[model samples]
Target: MTTHAPQTPGHPLPTGFPAGTMILTRRGLVPIEEVIAGDDVFTHQRLWRPVTAAMRTTAPTVRVHCASLASGLAATADRPFLTRVARVFLEGGEAGELSSAGWTRARDLAEGHRLASPLDFGKPVPVPDLPASLTGIDPADVLRTAGNMIRLKGEAAAALRPELVDWLAAQFGGYGARRRFPAWALTMPEELRTAFLDGLVNDGPQRDQFAVRMHSKSFMVGLRLLVCSLGFAGGLSSQGRPGKPGWLLSWKREGGRRPDHDGFRWHPVTRVEHGPEAEVFSLSVAEDESYIADGIAVRNRTERLTSL
Candidate 1:
C-alpha cells in the first residue's frame, strides 16, 4: 500500500530529454542519449564543460518550440531554461538600461518568452603588429616560401601573394606539418588574416559553397578556430575515405544584430506543448549545471534540491 509522490514546480525532478534531442558538444551536434560521461558540452556561457555523469530514465516531458529551432526543445517539466525576463531602467542620475534574465522552469514557459541562444560565432581579433623576426623579410622570399608550401608554380603561384607569407609558414610550420596555430593567431589583423586564408583557398582544392579541404588535420583545426574567431560558422570534417586522406573546413556567415550578452542571443519561444511520458537522457556538467540542447539553454539536475 504505497502512494505516488506529488510533483511540484521547481521540485528536484530529474532533468533530461528523449533520444532524438540534439546536444551541442565540442565535436558538434550529437544525440543526447548517445552522449556519455567525460564528453564536453557547450554551455550557455560559450564555455565547454565535461559531462560528469550521464543517465537514462523514464519520465514525463514537454516540447518547447522556439524561434530558429525547427525541431523544438524537449525536456522534463521541471527543467530550468535560461530565459530573459524583462528590461529595466536604472533610476539614478544617469539613465542606464539593463536586461533581466534568469532560469525559468519549462512548465512555466509560454509563448513570447525569450530563450537565450548562443551567438553564431565570435568576432575577429585584431593583431597590433607583425612578428619582429619576419618584419624585415623580403616580399620575394615570403612569396616563394608560401608558393612552395602549397606546391604552387608559375604565374598562378605569383598571383597567390600575401605580405606575410613567410610569417604564415613560420607560424603555422612548413608544408604537411601538423601543428595548431599559436596563441598569437587569436589576434590577427583583418587584412593579414584575410590574405592568409585567401592564399590557402586559391591554392588548395576548388572552393565549393565556401568549403575548403586541406591535407593536415591540425591545420584544418587551427584554420577552423581562426575562421570562427572572425564570427563565421566554421565546421571541420575529415576526408576519411580510402583515397582521400585529409580534412575539410567549411564556413557560413550569420550576420545579425549583436546579442545583449557576448555568449548568448535571446530567441523567443513560439510554442510549448506537454508530451507523453517517455525515456529521456540527462548529463551532470562540471560547472554551471547547464548545457545548450539544439541551441536552447537548459538546466541540468545536478543537485538533489534546486529551487526556482
Candidate 2:
C-alpha cells in the first residue's frame, strides 16, 4: 500500500498552502524605537527584505519595531494591486532588477535623520554655514508635541506635556510595566498574570517558554507607509542594512538674523531684522533684485562665495 508519510504537525503547514505569509520583527527579537534606530540597525537587511515582501502579500501583521516605530495595522495588507506593483521586494519575485531607485527614497530619509543631532532626535538638521541651531530641544521630547503643534494640538499625542516623555521612558526602561503592550504578557497568554510576573526579570521565566513571538509582520511595515518619501517620520535614524548615515547641517550664525514683517517671521539666514520705534529692533533680509535678475554679474564680482 502506497501511503504518504504522515504529516508532522504543530501549526500544520497549509496543504497547497493557505496563501501563507512569513513575518519577521526585530529581525526576530523586538525592542524600543530609539534603541532600534541606533547606529547598528543595518545589521540585518537581507532578512528584512523577504519579510517585507510577505507584508505586501499576506493578509495582515501586527508588529512593533523600533526600526520603523509604529504598530497596530490593518486594511492596507489586502491591497491586491500593491502586491503586483511591489513584487520586486518579495522573494521568488524581483528584488534584483529594480535598481537603486526602489530604495533611494527610504535611504535618503534614513540619512537625513542621522544628520540631525546624533545624541538627541529632537534637534533640526543644520544647514552648512547657515547661522542657527537645528533644534533647541531633545527629539524624544519634541516628537510628542510635533503633531500637536501643527494639527492635533492639546491632544494626548502632542509632546508639549513632559509627563508623556517620562511615561515613555518608564515603559521602555526594561523592568517597568508597559500598560499598552505589557512586555510580560507577550511571553505567556495575556489571561494569566502570575506567570507573566514570574517571567518579568532578566532571563526569567518570561524570557523563555512564554515570550510572545516577535515580528514585523504588520505595524512596523505600516510605518514604512507613513514615512515614504516624506523624510524621517520626525524621529531618529533607522538602522537597516546599508541604511544611510545621519547628517548635520551647520552654517554661520551672526547676530541680527531673525526679522519680523507684516506680523510674519522671516528666517534669519534669509533676512535681517530691525526693531520698531526709536524704532524697536526688527529683522531684515538680504534681498538682491540685481542678483535675481543677473546671476552671472554677481558670481563675477563676489569677494566671498558660500554654498547655501
Candidate 3:
C-alpha cells in the first residue's frame, strides 16, 4: 500500500505542494514552485541561489485576526483591495537554498517585513538627486473609477468597491469627500486650480492655455495607471511561468463629456493580433492622443499585450 501526506483543504498535494507560495527572488516575491535552481534569492546585501530544498514540517494552524491584518494593510500607500494567502520565500541566512519559511497571507505583510533586494550585476547605477513625482493629479479619481469599473462587473466582484473606498478613506480621511475634490486637487496652486476649472467651462486661447497645463497633469496620471495595470496583471499571471503565461493588460475610459479641444476624454480603439495562436478579449475606456501614443509605446515595448 502507498501512503501520501495529508493535504490542506483547498490546496493540492496536501502538505508538500508549494501552492500559493511566494519567495523573494531577484525579480521580486515569486511563488516557490516557480523558482528555478539557478534563480537568485535575496539576502541583506548578498544574492544566493536556491539549488535544492524540501519542506520538512507544517506548522499548526492559528487563528489570524482579520482586523489586525486589515489595519496593517491599511498603512500601505498602495494597498491592493483583493488579497489571498500564499507561501512566502525568505532567505535562509548564508545558506544557498531557499526555504518555505511559512505561510502568510499577502494582506498580512506588515511594515517591518523585509524582502530580498534585487541583484544588480556589478554595475555603477546613477542615483538621481531628486525623486520622481506624480504631481497635480487626483489619484482618488483614478482609483474610484477603477474601483467602479471592477464593481460593475457584477456580484462576483461586488466587494472591490467598498474595500477600495474604505482604504482610500483611511488614507486620505473625510476631507476629500467633504470638499468634493480629490486631496491632491485641493492642494494644487490656486491659480492652477482656477485655470483647470476655467478650462473645463470656457473656450478660446485662455482655455487652450489651461487645457495644456491640465492635460500635462492628466497625461502623467494616465501614464501611471497604464504602467501600474500592466505590472499588476503581469504579477497576477503567476510571473509568466510556462503553462501560465502572463498578459499585458490596459484599461480604457470612454463616453465622457469633453470640455475643450484638448480636454481629457477617453477614446476607444480596437486591435486584432494575428498569429498562429490568438484569443480575443475586450474592455472599454476613453483616451486622447497622448494616452494613445503612450499606449502604443507601451505595447511596442511589451509582449503578450492586452487592453481593458
Highest lDDT against the true fold, candidate: 1
Candidate 3 weakest lDDT stretch, 10 residues: 295-304
lDDT of 2 by residue, 80-169 (tens): 100001112232212322222111111112211110001111112221121123245444223323222222223433344544444433
Model 3's TM-score against the true structure: 0.20
For model 1, name the residue pairs that clash: none
Which scores better on lDDT, 1 or 2?
1
Q: What is residue 184's positional error in candidate 3, in angstroms?
A: 30
Judge candidate 3 against the unseen true structure and give its global Cα lDDT, from 0 to 1: 0.24
Query: What are the runs in model 2 whose C-alpha is more than 4 Å off?
Result: 1-79, 82-141, 144-162, 165-219, 229-308
lDDT of 1 by residue, 98-163 (tens): 246788888898754667765433333333345465577753344335534454534444355544
Q: What is the Cα-based lDDT of residue 19 in candidate 2?
A: 15
For lDDT, candidate 2 versus 3, the one ahead is 3
Q: On residues 1-308, what C-alpha lDDT tens digit does candidate 3 reach at each position?
A: 21212322543211111222233333333333444444454322222333222221232221111211110111111111111222232222122232322222223434322211111212222211111232344643344343342223334333544434443343322321121112232223434333433322333223222111111212222222222222111101111345443222222122212111111111111111111211111111112100011111100101111211
- Which sequence of candidate numbers ranks them by TM-score, best first? 1, 3, 2
lDDT (0 to 1) per candidate = 0.58, 0.19, 0.24
